[model samples]
Target: MTDVEAQQAHWAATFAAHPEMYGGQPSAPGAYAVELFVREGCRTVLELGAGQGRDTLAFLRAGLRVTALDYAAEALAGIEQSAGADAERLATVAADVRRPLPLPDASVDAVYSHMLLNMALTTPELEALAAEIRRVLRPGGLHVYTVRHTGDAHCGAGTALGDGMFENGGFVVHFFDRALVDRLATGCTLLDLTPFEEGDLPRRLWRVTLRREGP
Candidate 1:
């Protein structure tokens, strides 16, 4: 299998084996994104890589409509289970974000993703995804995403997976530097880029917020 295919298979198996891999609680970054959305009056949201629906549930509970997308079927299943009565407000789509998203242009008021941009994607793929995200958001909409930065402890300490990507603990991650983040913010006004840590190893991350500009 190619690297991409291998990574896909690995994620499928991993999610199937551990449905609660990320636990049932929403992440701090995810909760913060929701708070920002509420403050900005964003009602419709597109959640990329909505693993286990932990964050999706948080959004739904906050009375926001969420379109949750994850490549793993197991992850989508977990989303369905957690949605429950709120399933009416939550739509689940199984899709790989590296490809064209099945969403209409200027459809959502905001886009929220946690640790999705730092996946096993190349620079070009990441750029394409960013452009697609811009297309799907209405003018002046917000985009909140988190990525693993170069300063992370596992960045260069794991087995090399080519193209600045590393395989650590059976997970492949593409580390992003400040330059790459700036490049990815093309076509959007970058509002903020803040550093934060999560996980037992204190996985370092860059929480980026951007706004789509008008034509």
Candidate 2:
């Protein structure tokens, strides 16, 4: 199988085996995004990697319309099922984020993703994804995404896959450096870059916030 295809299969199997692999609770970044979105009066959110719908549920409970996108169809189904009373305010899409997002221009109030930007995608693909995020966001709309940075404990660990990506424990991660973060900020105004930690391994990450500019 191709590298991307293989990674997809791995994630599918991993999700099936673990069910709520990352737990059912919202992530720190997810919770933060909800608070920020609320304060910004964001009515709709498009989450790039809504694994198990943890953050998806958070947005729903906060009364924000959410569209959760992931490559795994089963995960999307699980989100819809788990949505329960919030299902009406939730939408799910199963597609690769590396490609163009299936949304019209200036469609969403905000975009959020937790660790989705650091997946097996290449640098060029990441730039494209950022552009796609810009296209879907209305003027002054916000985009918040987190990524493991080069300072992470496992940044250079395990198999090297080139372009800052490494495969350790069967999962590929693209460890970002500031230069890359700057490069991807093209066509958008970089708002915030916060360094943080997560999990037992204490993965080092950067929570990046960007704002789309009007033409």
Per-candidate TM-score against the hidden true structure: 0.96, 0.97
Worst ten in a row by lDDT for model 1: 1-10
**Candidate 1 C-alpha lDDT tens digits along 71-111:** 88777877888788998998889898878999999999999
Best by TM-score: 2
In candidate 2 the C-alpha lDDT for residue 12 amounts to 89
Q: How would you encode candidate 2's per-residue C-alpha lDDT over 1-215 as one tens digit per residue?
A: 77777988998899899996788889999999999999999999999988888889999999999999999999999999999999999989999987799999999999999988888888888889989999999999999999999999999999998999999999999999999999998888999999999999999999999988886
Q: Mind sharing the TM-score for model 2? A: 0.97
TM-score, cand. 1 vs. native:
0.96
lDDT of 1 at 10: 86
Error of 1 at 26 (Å): 0.9
The Cα RMSD of model 1 versus the native structure comes to 1.2
* Candidate 1 C-alpha error for residue 90, in Å: 1.0
Clash counts per candidate, in order, are 0, 0
